[model samples]
Target: MKPTRFIDSVNCAIEGILHATRTQKHMRYHFLAALAVLFTTLLLRVSSMEFMLLALAVSFVLFAELMNTAVEIVVDMISPGYHPLAKLAKDVAAGAVLVAAFGTAIMGYLVLARYVLPWQKAGLEMIGTESETGMVVSVVLVLIVVVIMKARGGTGTPLEGGGVSGHSAVGFCIATSVALHTQDPLIAVFCFILAAMVSHSRLLLRIHRPREVVAGGLVGVAITVAVHLLFRAFG
Candidate 1:
């Protein structure tokens, strides 16, 4: 339908985002990565100029990805079969996204390296006390991993039923992070119990099989623990 008003235009824009997010795994990954980067930036408290640069880098990559998806769709519809020109068009569009992503990665490293490397000065004993960074990284990694799993398995959409349950993964991920940061047995046990309950709920609803839920919980815990250890070692 043609957009007839400002609100209609906004809704149409949102629909495009939703379409890309649902159909394109890379787009979903970019969205999650963008969130993680922005959250880290807030915690790092970078300079205004640095913040603007990071924001622009993120926007550039996302824009490139969206354009790539659009180009591929158009090419497929126009060609609908083997066509060297269509293939070239899609490849060129994909190459643009790849270049944008690479430049964004370099920009991010230049902006964040100074702030992150300073963690070496902090004592190891004191490092575990800060779980914010570890938790954020763990959750983001789990989400990305889940997205990949869903895309590969072709079992479900991004949010609901999948080969691995993202909700379960994130639930257990945060629980493990909390347990590690607190270093209190009581809190650890409580957190695991909550995580288990969350995983079990998926089973109860029959949204996920026992193995899928278990796999998600295990993935969550494994990723979170690895992240915690890395932060402690470097931070």
Candidate 2:
């Protein structure tokens, strides 16, 4: 489809991503790995320069993979028959992805090595965490996303599994909010433990599967962490 409007162009780009993610397991893996790495940067409080370098490396790998996927699709479409040239094209594209991935891995290791804490690190103690405004925004945003997820799934009510857990989501959201606001590792640990119990009850009662409860908890925690990170990153 030809994109005539700005929104259409954006939609087309997102569609490409969706198609790639659905069809390519490697793309999905890279996305999950990138998410984990980005979250680690947040937790480690890496310098902005280091974060930018890591982000660039991630982008380079993703870009190479996307191009490789595009090349493979085009090659398959054009050469439905078995041909050495087609195989070579695919192999070369795959090779590009491998090289890009390897380089990015090295870059990530170098950037993160110094930031990683030693094995004998001191006890966990976080101080002067995010502001009140960030905490409030995070909780509100988590609630909004939870509702959206529940509505989109439409399989079960908020409290039930099959859908986002109204109880577990809010429980985790509040727990995350309090944890960030308190700036105490022990407090954060305790709050998250409580949140886990709330989700566990859902599992024991059979109102939702373990997957559903875990999904809800992840949603809440992810949203809260993202909001706090945004606040800390910009303000």
Clashing pairs in 2: 158-166
Q: Write the residue-wise lDDT of candidate 2 on 1-235 in tens digits.
A: 6889999999988998888889999999999999999998999899999999999999988898899899999999999999999999999999998998989888877887666533212222232366789877877887788778878887877545557776687789888778767655556666888999988888888888877788888888888778877887888
lDDT, each prediction: 0.87, 0.81
C-alpha root-mean-square deviation, each candidate: 12.9, 13.5
Candidate 1 lDDT by residue in tens digits, 40-149 = 99999999999999999999999999999999999989999999999999999999999999999989988997887446334333445546877899999999999999
- The residue pairs that clash in candidate 1, if any, are none
**lDDT of candidate model 2 versus the reference:** 0.81
Among all windows of 10 consecutive residues in model 1, the one with the lowest summed lDDT is: 118-127
RMSD score of candidate 2 (Å): 13.5
Give the poorly placed runs of model 1, Cα more than 4 Å off. 120-235
Candidate 2: list runs displaced more than 4 Å: 120-235
